[model samples]
Target chain A: MSPPAALRAAGLVKSYRRGRAVDGVDLTVALGERVALLGPNGAGKTTTLLMCLGAVTPDAGTVEILGHRLPRERSHALARVGFTAGYLPLPERMRVVEYLRLYARLAGLRRPDVAARAALDRFGVSHLARAMGTELSSGQKTLVGIAKAVLHRPALLVLDEPTASLDPDVALRVRTGLREISAELGTALLVTSHNMVEVERLCERVVFLSAGQVVANGTPAQIIDRYGHDDLEGVFLHLS
Target chain B: MPTIEVYHGAAASFWRVMAIARRHAYVLQRSPHRLFDIIVWPVVDVILFGTIGVFAAGRLGGAGQVALYLLVGVVLWHVVYQAQISLATGFLEETWSRTVLSLLVTPMREWEYVAGVALFGLVKLLGGVGAVALIAWAAYAFKITTLGWGLIPVAALLLAVGWAIALFVIGLVLRFGSGAEALAWGILFVVMPLSGTFYPVSALPAVLRPIGTLLPTTHAFAAGRAFAQGAATPWHELGLAAAGTAVMLALGFGYVVWMLRVFRARGFVTRYS
Candidate 1:
């Protein structure tokens, strides 16, 4: 039998008085598959991602993560799903290890401290485990945030602009680390980013969202060909 | 997302609750200033209030009567005030750190978060109450424990009021964001004057009398004062306080749960995240 989909969102819709933020969107990621969600500002990419994570309730539609339905069974779904966003901040007063341990425990790890230690090691951040969250640079925080998300070895991992603020060197390192980690764990990855280079490097398939609708979905090369462009960035600009 | 079977069983759920409490405790540990503030504030309040209580008691009644009265009022009021602030601040802390999104993504339920924060507040309540009780006995010869075993019910009722106020504050913070943070500290004071903490409910203006009578604090302090004076524990006032607590709990819990659902539906989860 085919593996269950990592994420499945159907006819999702969300609206504000100003306008619809996400409108009748459907998306899916298969088990162990890596996918990228691409869109311009106001294209509702983030809103869709939020719905998949069950953080935002859809106005209309269904989302199933790892087979559990959204909003209703979010708690069950979230147990094996992890999320990280570059913009989400960690507690300033907590040490890195302390923060990670808290999340590990919340994720229901049997030995949270051990899992936290291993995550820190996997991310090569064990050296900074004692540092306070506020003391870390944006790049370091991103690394720690990613480490926290993966501590429980979640089956489905969602990342929003994971390396948005990192320098080229750090971003490259993050990309390499994520690739290695995902491969080792066989975790399905759903990522949203404007960095076409990062998307091209990490995601085999891309879903282009425009005005809260999926305008394009295919391999990077296929999208490039469809847009009559030489690269993924050209296709992104064309669709967005 | 693939429906992965990764259930954190009932046993683990309990641990998750403790983990939330542990998270707050670690934050407190890292910030000695926060711990110091919680400990020092109540002690200072006792010293300041106790001195005034001494002078005020000379005018109203015997020293012993005044000390017990003042001590009970001060201690119980802190219990209510600190409990509300502690719970409200727990929510605010998550907002300030932009960690609410991180928290919501886990298997942790809203009730788990509430219970954990409430537990943390209970710890603070103990610290504040302990320090005040010690000072009351050491300095004023007034034993707070002497309010009889009935003090347990009184304290529980007062804490219920605190939890209600805390839930209201949580609703405000969730709805209005950090801008309404001042309500955490300001809310208790708004009701304090009408609460009949230092005076009888009848002393208030006629229009304010009904409002005072409705507040659980007013009834709590009345019963506490009566107990201090070696009078019959005011069972009627205690009953009124319990009824009032029920109302506040309903309103507070109802408002918070409703606002949270609206917030989640509106995708406000990422507002701070």
Candidate 2:
């Protein structure tokens, strides 16, 4: 029998009082495969991510992370999963090393400090180790956050708009680090971003959502070709 | 790297809990305001209130009895308040830093987080409560240790009451978000007056007596007060408070867990955006 996918979220549904936010969304990310979920505002992207992370219970459907089901086996699933997002910033009072070390321990690493240092080195941000969260610039914070997330080297790493706020140069650094993580660690990447250029550069495939449902799912080049657009952004503009 | 080796069971839970406490400790070590909170204001409270208790002795015609009554109440009040504030604010710290969702995604369970914050609170209030106790002794000739071995149960019941109240407030915050955040401090306004922390339950009016009696802290205070007035061990009252405290913990912990589920179901936790 084949190994289960790194992540399989099937037939997911969610609703708020206003209306259904996510409707019958199915998403899967294979081991070491890089995929992005792209959508505009109110497209239910965050809701879907939260459900898959087991932070929000689904109205209907099942989500499995590395073959461990969510909302039921949430603890076991979370133990092997690492997540980072721009919205969830690092703790302002904690130094970068302190934050990473704590998460490493939380992930049950035997040598959290060593693992944290290796993660910092992997992201090429070892100089920011002693800086407090309040001291780091936005780009630096994102790097530290990624290091913290990957410290335990989980099978899957979920990132939300990981480079959304950075300057082009810093964004390049982030993209390079993420690509290395995907290639060297074989960490399955499930990303959400509006940066179509970065999506094309970093992710092998794209899943586009509009009004709470998947409207397009293919390789960036294929999606662009299918829509007769010059690039992924043009395709996005076409969909929007 | 597929190097994920997730820790499991009780031992892992211990380290996870300590990780949370250590995170707070780092904040505590660096933030001046946090240090002020642990030391300055609580010490000021002891001096300010202990003076009142001493003045009330003259006004109430009991020499030192009224002093002990109010002073003992104030000291224990700090004990309970410290437990509640420490836990509530520790949890609040996560929200302010926007790390609550991050912590949730980790292998750490909800109970472990709660216990960790409560554990930190326990470590913290010891210094705060001890400082207050020392001042109460030096300034007002009121040594809490005079309660002797009885001090254990008195402080235990009071701490239980504090934790119960804080847990419920946390549940409110989880379900309602910051709309209920004020209760983290404001609820104490109602709790302090209703629990009769400053006076004897018998001193309260008939309409309010039953309400005061219902609080485990009230029963615990009654024992402390009886001892101050030269009665030996007030086991009957202590016994009652202990039983009441057990009920309170069950209700408080259960309420928080249910609210957490509701937070998940209603997807309020997605507000991290």
Candidate 3:
């Protein structure tokens, strides 16, 4: 009847010799809904994100992306999912345009060059397209990474500390673009960031992961009220 | 902007693989080191080795057949080396650039990435191998065409083993990260003597002869020598070479795929640095 959620990850678990990295974590994001996965360092936020994207296969769990089972139908699922992280750097040898075009084509865009340029323009960084990967400032690199992530208009867009390096104004601009994509293209946004205020501004829901488990999940207002916190930052501090 | 349709089926996958190739093509075009690795270095190798081959032939009472044998062997070895290095280095480039996670996130399958780069590997070495072949002829007057129909199997067997080495190196990288990076560049040298590129398996030490004979490239080279000597096609050796290639290929592809699973399970896929 209704379209399946953009992402549905249930009882996702992954372990290493160091012990369990993700412990039976479950998450769901509706189509076009904006959600944030927030956690402290070593809290397994990135691991959960990777599992959702099929980059990391969980030892125990089922991840259905855009209604397609992960690893089995990864090609079908990931075709509609785009992911980016500031920690995952761009190729040093590639120009920004070429880098964006590569991801665009990989996402199945027929006119990848046009889409790449448009994405850059959307983020007001069209001039950086010719810049070599090493030449970009940290903030500029993150901006280009976001541009690359959104170029394909993926059904579910995942970002990891995406705007960590951007100036406030640039961050606001990028956030606005993200909102526009979700509204116009129904591109569900699943993001992880430390900027609590920006998270409040951008995401409709917040998921707090602590020690590889969901400690809290609800709307920002609901979570704040339930935790009796002044803001999302207070709740995050309490969780930590 | 034109409406960009979300693609499906084989056609979309084909283009996605091409995008992988296109990215590599751009890197090759822009990076001086890559261009040198694929082109200039091979030319220099050809010149240096071709000269030695010519001197050796001269030393053998002006017997040009010896020159042809040495020259052909040199050319084939370089071709296989270039072929093997292309795939391994193409993969290592992603790790070096810290972009493996970004790559894995897309719709492109792992096999597609390997296939695209492997195909590019062919393109990358063609110019270099061709250049060496030409130099072997121009400097030594020894044409590879002299090997006749036998050349096809020799080249195919060598390339198969080359691809096998690449898969093995890639598996090592996926399993051990950059710590095993040396394997990507150096594994083939370990396989070189066992392959008998310039010498017969019988010439190896007894301990190595057994290992040498186990290699497809060894048999391939032995068959090539028979052709050079105007002997009939060495069907027995040729058969052994083809069968060995089949087994190595299966093991290679299987091992890499397994290593990828291990990598993903360890959550190292996106931990790229």
Candidate 4:
């Protein structure tokens, strides 16, 4: 089968009155590829991700998701994408099953219940499906958040700091699930996280952003080698 | 198949908002204290003001007249209070739970989101108003003889005005964070005393009449009282009030739309950092 671009952004520029938050950045991801966005605080990582999801508009740029332009025609584009952010949580008062089913329906799933349960089982959180969202621990909440994002089986997945608060074991389980999702569904995965080890292990490619600009772009190994670091963390510290 | 798909898409958006509202209502159900606070607070205000009217009957008006007047003011005030508090608190709650960012990423537009929240607020306000009106009617024989079909339009206008005020408050909250809550309450206090809510505008000092006329609630109360008293409403005043309400609503909605643009531009939607 011929490869298709799952996501593409060109000349993405977003600015506040004081200064630019994301400055003329460009990026692309192909189906079945797992890309990690690496950056320190104030690096415009989240801004880039929000722009891709059409949650924020760019002052100057073009974002095409699965061949659909963003912001101007985001409804069609978003229907084919799923997103999660570290700061955004599920409604705590809602039951896991209720929240997931609601999002599944919103994602246009025909069988929301089955799809929601399948996602929960995929993440090994099936037992918590009936529990209230507020009752879940931090790690459990993160897992549920990821499950909700993927339940729709979108062509693209964007996760912002997806595993920031998880313990090692839960984080590993999440990574494994993400890998399976990409391999099985050919979904393009673009994720941002501060965990360099996880990025190095899961991502085939890495993009390093610093102060609202792209500073590095290559494979994890290649980027690390060019920065003359043994690991992604060392490379991050060197650049940041 | 394409038509079915389109229908499904629209239904999904509707259901998403309904789900949010349902979950919120459920949480509110669990917090009986909050429910009681909203429902009972207005009732207490009516009783307190009613008693004060009774003691000052010689100075103000008769017990029945004072109760009739205060009941209209209290009910209308409750509507405004409920609408403003719900709008501000609902957005704040979403922000606190980080759910607003999640919703922003969805296919729903900003107008649709605001409409859904406003509808929810309207339902809650109407329920509170109904309960208070029922109680006052039973206890004090608060007769509303001319409260015919005409009252429906007045109520609808009042609801729209309340929602508009709430939207303005929501914009303030978004701009200044939780500190805006204090400002909102302070503004309400200032308006309540000056708007001829508890007493007639005629009783107001000559200097304050213009200030009272500027308030939309002043017109709402006057219209409501006229309906209750079986008197011909001053259509000119009502028309002017409706125009003022429309203007306020347009300005309030405009400010909210502007604020959302600012929030999106600044990446405040995901600015948890």
DockQ of 2: 0.65
Q: Candidate 2 regions off by >4 Å?
A: B1-6
Better by DockQ, candidate 3 or 1 = 3
Which segments of candidate 4 are over 4 A away from where they belong?
Answer: A1-4, A15-21, A108-111, A225-229, B1-9, B58-63, B143-146, B270-273
Looking at model 3, how many pairs of residues clash?
A: 0
Q: Write model 4 residue lDDT over B1-273, tens digit each, in one string.
A: 011122255676676566556655765665577566368876787677655655566576455677667767776677777776666666666766667767777666666567666667766786677766666666655533346655665676677676777788778766666667675556667767777877777789999998888877778778877777778876865786688789889999999888877766666665432
TM-score of 4: 0.90
Give a tens-digit lDDT track for model 2, residues B1-273: 224454668878988999989998987888778766567867898888888877777687656766777777878887888899889888888877778789888888888898888899998899888888888888878888766777788888899888999999999988888788889888877878777777777778899889888988888988877766668789899999999999999999999999999989898876644
Interface RMSD of 2: 2.4
Relative to the true structure, candidate 2 has a C-alpha RMSD (angstroms) of 1.9
Clashing pairs in 3: none
Candidate closest to the true structure, highest DockQ = 3
lDDT of 3 by residue, A2-29 (tens): 4789999999998888888899999999
Candidates, DockQ? 0.56, 0.65, 0.75, 0.46
Cα lDDT tens digits for candidate 2, A9-96: 9999998998999999999999999999999988988889999999889899999998988877888888778899976778889899
Comparing to the true complex, what docking class would candidate 2 get? Answer: medium
The estimated TM-scores of all candidates read 0.95, 0.96, 0.96, 0.90
